[model samples]
Target: MQDAILDVKNLSIRYNGASEDAVRGVSFTLGRERLGIVGESGSGKSTVGRALLRLLPGARVTADRLRFEDVDLLDLSEREMLKVRGRRMSMILQDPKFSLNPIQRVGAQVAETYLRHFPANKAEARAKTLEMLAAVRIRDPERVHDLYPHEISGGMGQRVMIAMMLLADPDLVIADEPTSALDVTVRLQVLNILDGLVRDRGIGLIMISHDLNLVRNFCDRVLIMYAGRVVETLDARDMDAAEHPYTRGLLAAQPRIGGTRGPLAVLDRRPEWKEGSTP
Candidate 1:
């Protein structure tokens, strides 16, 4: 079995001035493989992802245990956490437009990201950046290198974001709806790039998305979340065997291609589950 790359235990987070916890006693383990997290918006899915990286600002984070590679994340000082963030663990946000600097050339930004974590010379970093851009299937890496973020299409920008993150050579990547804003074709292309990255690099991935079909096809294991907690987890191959009502409801909501159906099934809305109750 692959070794555990992340271990979260009784983790909780509450934003400042919020009456309710965004995440509550959430716990799970990640191995060196793909683990998909599926939940609708406002389900604290993104909160969990940010919390893992200690990226939640103006929020209180608490956990009995949060470990990565036997290192206790909760115990690390901010200075120490800085060393871990981009080097050992990285995240790709939904939109690269907001993530990438508008003024900087894409290539320079990517190279800078690499240099932040590694002691490589300028020539080495630039070469590595070009290679990463090519790895993400960007056409004409040499030309694209000098282009600013605004000069690129949405898909190209996203690819640049991926190239930057990958340059850190992170062991684990948290991709939070990484393709949510892209067109259908671009979405697939990005997914393919991500697929190759995981396969070739042997890095673990936590793909957080509400797209059931994508998760079903791409992930090795899946976690179904509602309200701030995991309601079910199953092997991707056994997703059809999901036992929770919420999981079934979600699956039923997806329209099958080439099949005529009535209005999409509506999910039953319950009051968000309290922390002490069953998910």
Candidate 2:
């Protein structure tokens, strides 16, 4: 895409002492679009997300070209990368329990991002925090602001986490199974909030998830990964047209409510699929 904000080409990553790369030759470009990456456990979904932000401390992350906007992400110094994180880019982690500070009040933690990137006073930061909390559809932002992380419900915590990451108006947002811990209603609510941000704010989104149905209905494009590589890429509405055997197997494995009453399909892994796919 000519308007691409992120370009990743020939990317591969391997942890120290590992014989093979955990993520092998992953390549894709992100415009102001919602791109979904779906795969089973250990298929390098989250690994790819962390690799982009250079969060894999012990892993060797390599790419021929990994550029975010005008900057080369792979070549940046850690100190320089820190400037990009939160201000230019943000990551909404999987669970609120782990992502949020247990002891910090909700408002202070959300306000920290605003204070870190901008020259803002405490009162200004608090206003922005409360505004963002309300923006995410939280009721009674003033009361929730002073509450500790442990004081909120799981669904509310997800909203607070979204607010904290988005408080600075980042250009790119990486959500790693962001709603895995929520119920059906809360999941849709959180997804709607993300959809609005991508639509209204024009921020590029990469949603790393295992739920095919979620990505099918939510994302614009879908990347199907198997054995640490993207096996197929297609429009989310065209998942049924996937050509890869692994992709087909995944589609077959998901049980439908009113469809067949027979047993769900089991994936038959093949070693040939371990090789990297051509871009």
Candidate 3:
């Protein structure tokens, strides 16, 4: 972990007046590799991502240690955290419609991040914005650049979001259900772009999703989360060898291409499973 870009330990988050923490005792280190967090909805996977970026408004977040590079995120004020958000670290949200400005042109939105973080003039930012759009494999970047978010398709919008978030070449990128909006073909394309970013630039990536198969195929490491805690963490290729019952159950529940054409096995809920127990 000496070269880890992000180190989080005992991180927890709770919304106002919540009976229990939304995220509990999550700890993991992200190096320059793709780390996927997999769990069902409301499993605190997204909460962990938001907590890292300090984006959980009106929520109490605490951690024994939360460091990005050499900077301690927990100690930084909101104003100081702004300096780190887009330049040093960035997040790709699940949906582009909610993440992007409906009124602004896609090119302007992408250029805005580069302009905000770097001392680039309008022309320079625009050039870099078009370059990034092309980097994400968007055809005719010129036309897409001037189109509004509503004018683009879901896949294109997601690509625009990706272009904007990565314009600054952040050291860490947290993607929450990044490819969920695209078709299988577009999903692979987007995944390839993310893979290239990590492989070529050495940027750490945290990919949050419920797709076990996708994570196993695309990521270097996988963290299995249940309820509010991480039940297990293992190499992506070793996911089938996961010892935790929750992870094993999840793997079994997935319908295989040539497997029996029967109803998927139901996940048996166990009270003790939520106690942060890991086999």
Candidate 4:
């Protein structure tokens, strides 16, 4: 059996005054490998990712077990959590514009992140930040460092955000829609960078996304979710062999390039309708 890096059992999350849990009875395990979660909007995929980082305070999260590196995440105090976050575990937000501070120089912000976890001098921190920038394939690291968030392109801003997250040398990275904002060509480039990071650093990754095709190509395993519940899980390479109706529907909805589908099969939404629900 693979060594478990993260084990989440029967995890559930409920927002204040919500009729039901946002995440319902979710359980999964991660080794030192890449795992992908795919679903439509409001599917609780992002909620599961955020809950692992303890990022949602107003949302109640409970689990029979939520352990990272054999430590119970629920039991840690805020101070203790600070030591673990960004050092051993980190997250990349969906949008760089909101994730990054608009006023801070890119280089200084990244350098500060490095210094927070590493006992380094200012010069050392600056050097490390520049190295990380180069590692992410950014050209002119020096000039880019001095520029504010608005001065860079969306793709470059994303790379800067990634550089900051890696500053702490985290073993696990949860990337939530890391390439959602990029154009098709740029999206592939960003995914390539992420692929390199996982392969070269042996960092465990939980990539949360709504794009089935992207996850199938970029990840090792895939979990398909619907309405806050995971309905299917399979090998990414074998996603074509998925058995669930919902999974099959998602695959059928994709438009093929060379040919036209006769009917363009519509997903059967009736299964989602409950006794009193009108959706």
Scored by CA lDDT, what does every candidate get? 0.88, 0.91, 0.90, 0.88
Instruction: Point out where model 2 deviates above 4 Å.
Output: 276-279
lDDT, candidate 2, 1-279, per-residue tens: 889989999899999999988888899999999999999999999999998888899999999999999999988999999999888888998899989999999999999999999999999999999999999999899999999999998889999999998889988999999999999888999899878866889999999999999999889999988778888899999989888888889989988889788988998988878875632
Q: Give the TM-score of candidate 3.
A: 0.97
Question: Model 2, residue 111: what's the lDDT?
Answer: 95
What digit string (tens of lDDT, one per residue) describes model 3 on residues 1-279? 879998899998999899999889989998889999999999999999988899888999999999999899998999999999998899998888888999999899999999999998999999999999999889899999999999998888888888888889899999999988678887887788778866788888899999998899989999989888998999999987889888999998999999999999878978988894764
Which candidate number has the best lDDT?
Answer: 2
Off by over 4 Å in 1: 271-279
lDDT of 1 by residue, 57-144 (tens): 7899999888888678877889999999888899999998899989999999999988888889989999999999999999899999
TM-score of each: 0.95, 0.97, 0.97, 0.95
TM-score for predicted model 1 compared with the true structure = 0.95
Cα lDDT, model 3, residue 90: 93
Candidate closest to the true structure, highest TM-score: 2
- Model 1 deviation from the true structure expressed as Cα RMSD, one decimal place: 1.7
